[model samples]
Target: MIEAQGLFKRYGDKTAVNGISFTVHPGRVTGFLGPNGAGKSTTMRMIVGLDTPSAGSVSVNGRRYAEHRAPLREVGALLEAKAFHTKRSAYNHLRAMAATHGIPNSRVNEVIEMTGLGPVAKKRVGGFSMGMGQRLGIAVAMLGDPQTVILDEPVNGLDPEGVQWIRHLARGLAAEGRTVFLSSHLMSEMAMTADHLIVIGRGRIIADAPVSEILAGRGQLRTRVRTDRPSDLLAALRGDGTTSTFLEPDLLEITGPDPRRIAEAALRQQVLVYELTPLQASLEEAYMELTASEVEYSSHDLSLGPPAQGVSEGSRS
Candidate 1:
């Protein structure tokens, strides 16, 4: 597991990361999410000992990354895929990294096959495509067979197949009881891949919870009720804090009341209820609602033109 307590990082007068604390447990994929300039990379860098923390502590498997005799075997990270020498062949690169801790050459070949880099293992890093480079980077990270893995935007330049491969790889790593912590801007992918979520904004932790709990707690519960008697049901359901909207002649979307209460009201008024389905908020919607105010940058229009008129045919010509 990974533990961070009161972690902070500052550069001169600017604070990149404020006091934040969170734990990433093993046997689960914990997704780190944030908008641009939200200090995600900075925190990841601190975890791997690439950046010095101004205050507080972060440790992997009960020890700071630098304190480990074989740091790579303790924590495998792909902070920057392009940090490798561009002129080196993918095979040689992994060989060099493995040589650091006296890892065997056979282990390097195993990771190459595992990451689907066997075919291009002999190709130079500079000639590899973005997706190939990402694969190579992952291969290097897995070379040490670490217990804790950290990947930043692993699917940034991947195709659909490559993205799916990464999703499976992360879950597989966690299933083996390895701590998997990753950051990505893809909400849909994160929703499908992550078992838990950690959201950060403005140099501070905003939310840290299970994916299901975050979805259930961020927004009000809504229900879709289809009844034959729309008007009568609407009246019977009318009360303080209750709201209803008609999607069609017989379909009603309701908020501020549980499905059981709605059914009770319908039965009390002798209304015919055909269907009642609870509608839970999606992860994307919950994320937006939670981070709406925490966003650091927003667009605003400053133009003072007379509300530009529609273009005419002559203007198009």
Candidate 2:
């Protein structure tokens, strides 16, 4: 497990990471999410001792990273995929890394096959494609059979199959009782891969919860109701906290009420309801709503002709 308490980082006058505390438990895939400039990379670097913390502490498996006798065997990290010698063959790169930890050549070959890098194991790192480079990086990270794994944007350049592979690999690691912490911008994939989420914005932690809880609390539940008597249904649903909007001549999108409530309201008004469908809140919607105010840089749509006074550009989206 990984635990951080009041972790902070500062560069002169600017604070990159505030006093944030969170725990990544074993047997789960914890996703770290944030907008650009949200200090995600800085925090990850701090965890592995790449960047020193300004005021707090972080530990992996109950000890600081540097305190581990064989750090690679305790925790594996892929903060940057291109952090290897470009001229060396993939196999040689892993061999060199394993040599530092006294890991055997047999273990090196095992990771190569496990990461699907066996075919190109003899190829130079510089000539590998982006997807291949990512695979090689993962192979290096797993070389020591670490109990904790950290990956940043693991699927950045992967194809569909490669994406699925990483998803299963992350879950598989967690199933084996290892701590798996990853960062990604792909909400759809995160929704499928992550069991929990740690959301940060502007150097501060915004949310840390289970995936289901976050979705339930962030976005409103909406229902789509289709009926020939749209007017009667609308009149029955018009009240405080209950709104109806007409999407088509016979289709109405109702908010602030569930499908059962809308159906009963329509029935009491003598309206004919042909369809009532509930729209569950998606992870994308929940993420956007939670981070709406925390985004540091936001683009404006000139077509909207300047946002209203005191309203943020992100909110307009």
Candidate 3:
């Protein structure tokens, strides 16, 4: 497991991380999510002992990274794939890394196969495509067969196939009871890969819980209700224990009441009901809603939502 206890970092007058604490447990994928410049990279660096915290500390497997015996065998991380020597072959790069811990060639080859880099293992990293470079970086991280893995944006330049491969690899690693701590800007990826989520914003921990719990805790639950007499249904739903908002004349968005209860109320009030589908905000939509203000850069003009149909003034992702 990886633990950050009140971790803090500062550079001159700017605080990059502000006393945030969280844990990454074994046997599950723990996704670290935040907007860019939210201190994610800084926190990961501190965890791996690349940067010393100004106020607190982080430890992996109950020991500081520098103090670990056989550190490579305990934790493997791909913090920055671009940090590797560009002239070195992918295999040679892994070979050099393995040599640091006296790991053998066989293990290097195993990771090569596991990462689907056999064909390009002998190619110089400088000439490899971005996807290939990402694969090579992953291969190096897995070289030590460590119990804990940390990957930052592992799928940054990957294709659909490569992304799928990484999803499977992360899941497989966790299935072996290893701790997987990763950070990604992709909400769809997080929704699919993570069993738990740690959401950070403005250098602060916003939410840390199981995926279901985080989603539930992050937003208010609303149910979509369609009835023949939408006005009556709205009136019936707005009471001591219920709240309703109108989305359309025939559809009323209701909350604070279960479907069964709403149905009973509608039936008792002679409101003909047709549809009642629970509404949930997609992870992407929820994340955008949560971090909209936290984003450091604005890609679109807020005043201009988007261009009209067949127009190209701005686009929304």
In candidate 3, residue 232 scores what lDDT? Answer: 74
lDDT by residue (tens digit), candidate 3, 157-218: 99999999889989999999999998988889999999998988768887788888767755
Give the top-scoring candidate (lDDT).
2
How do all the candidates rank in terms of lDDT, highest first? 2, 1, 3
Residue 313 CA displacement from its true place in model 2, Å: 9.0
Q: How do all models score by TM-score?
A: 0.84, 0.91, 0.87
Ranking by TM-score: 2, 3, 1
**TM-score of candidate 2 to 2 decimals:** 0.91
Backbone atom clashes (below 3 Å) for every candidate: 0, 0, 0
**Candidate 1 least-lDDT 10 residues:** 308-317
lDDT of each: 0.88, 0.89, 0.85
Better of 1 and 2 by lDDT: 2
Q: Per-residue lDDT tens digits of candidate 2, residues 1-317?
A: 99999999999998989999999999999999988678888999999999999999999999999999999999989886788799999999999999999999999999999999989999999999989999988998899899999998899899999999999999999999999999876677789999999999878899999999998887577889899999888778788598778899999888898888888888799899988899888999888887778877666677777754433545435
What lDDT is obtained when candidate 2 is compared to the true structure?
A: 0.89
List model 1 lDDT by residue over 189-249, tens digit each: 7898999999988688999999888887976878999999989987887885888889998
Q: Which structure is stronger by TM-score: 1 or 2?
A: 2
